[model samples]
Target: MSKVLIIFIKNPVAGKVKTRLAATVGDTTAVEVYKNLLHHTQNITHLMAADKFLFYADFLQREDEWPNEQFIKHLQKGNDLGKRMHHALEQVFLNKYKNVLIIGSDCFELTAAIIEEAYLVLEDKNIVIGPAKNDGCYLLGMKNPQPCLFKNVSWSTSQVLQQTISICTREHLNDCLLPTLTDIDDENDLSVEQKIYFKLKKSAQ
Candidate 1:
C-alpha cells in the first residue's frame, strides 16, 4: 500500500510556464493562469493519503507555495517529457514504492477523487491512465517500472495516449482507463470560470 504521487510542475516564471497558453494570453497572464492551476493542484493533493513528490521542471523552489513539510521536491533530470517522467517513476520505484503515479500541473479538471480512483484501479491492474483530449493524458499510474512505455514514443503530440496504449497492449500489461479529462494547454481549453478568474487576476495585477 506504499503509494507515491509525483507531481511535475514548472517554475512559475513569466515566460517559461504555459508557453502554449501564453501564445494567446501573453506570458504574464499565462503565468497567472499556471499559478492558479498550481494552487488548485496543491489544494487537491495536500491531504491525499500518499507520499507526495514534487518534480520541478526547472529549479526547485524551497520557499514557494509547495511547502517543504508536505512535498518532497526534486529537479527533473531528463531532456524530454517522456524521459523526465520515466526518471521520476524509476526514482520512486527504486525506493520500493508499490504504486507510483505521475501528473502535471496543466490539468484543471484533475481532482483528488480521480487520483484516488487511479490508485484503486492500480490495486487490480498493472497500469491506469487518465486520458486527455487530443491523445494526451492527465495522469498515468503504474505498479511497476515499465521503461518500454516511454521508449520511442512521441511526446507532446496528438498520438501520445494511443501510442502508450499500444505499448501496453504489446507488453501484455493489464491496463485500466479512467474518465477522460482535459489539460488546459490552449486558450480554447479554458472554462468560463477560468476565463473570468484570469481577467480578474490580470486586473488585480
Candidate 2:
C-alpha cells in the first residue's frame, strides 16, 4: 500500500516557536531547541520508505535543511491546530494514498522504527496514535480520512489524547495505540543531556 508521512513544523523563529519552553529558557534558547528537534525529525524521516511531505506552519520555504529533492513541501491550511491537521489529512486522502500519518517536530523520542510501526499497524487497523506523555499526541495515522477525530479537540492540552480516544470510540473506528513518548514542551521536560547541551550552547554564544 502507498503510504505518506506528513510532518507539521513551524518556521524556527525566536519568540515564536516553543513558547511554553521559552517561558523558562530564553527565546533564543527555545529556537535553538526547536532547531535541534527539527534536525532530529529530519534524521528519522528522510530515509523512510513512505512518501514524505513537509507541511510548514506559515509559508513555504524553497531552500532549507530539509532536502527539497526528497520531501514534497506544502503550507499547513486552516486556523487552529485541529483544523490544520484535519485539512492536511483531507488533502493527502484525496490524493489516494492508502495509509497516511502526521507528526509534529516536538517529540525528541519519536524514531523511524516507531513511525514504521505506525504505518505497519494500519494494515489491519483504522487508525494509530502515539500519545505524548502529557501534552497531547505526537503521532496520528489513519488509512482513511476521519474528520471526527480532529474535531472538538483542545489542542496543546492534557485532555487531547483522551478526547481523541473518546472520538474514536464514539465513531467505532478500530484504533491502535503506539508507545507513549515525551514531548519537549516544558522546561522540566528537558533531559540531562539536553540540559548540558543548552548550557554549552549558551557558553559558546
Q: Could you give the C-alpha RMSD of every candidate to the true structure, in order shown?
A: 1.0, 0.9
Please give the TM-score that candidate 1 achieves against the real structure.
0.97
Model 2 — which ten-residue stretch has the worst lDDT?
148-157
What would the per-residue lDDT of candidate 1 be over residues 1-205, giving only the tens digit for each residue? 4989999998999988889999998999999888888999999999998999999998988998888999999999999999999999999999999889999888888899999999999999999999998679889999999999999899999899999999999999999999988888888899998898898888888
TM-score against native, each model: 0.97, 0.98
Q: What are the per-residue Cα lDDT tens digits for candidate 2 across 1-205?
A: 4989999999999989999999988898999999999999999999998889899999899899999988999999988999999988888888899789999999899999999999889999999999998949999999888998878899878999999999999999999999999999978888999988997997789
Task: Name the candidate that leads on TM-score.
Answer: 2
Residue 40 shift from truth in candidate 1, angstroms: 0.5
Q: Between which residue pairs do clashes occur in model 1?
A: none
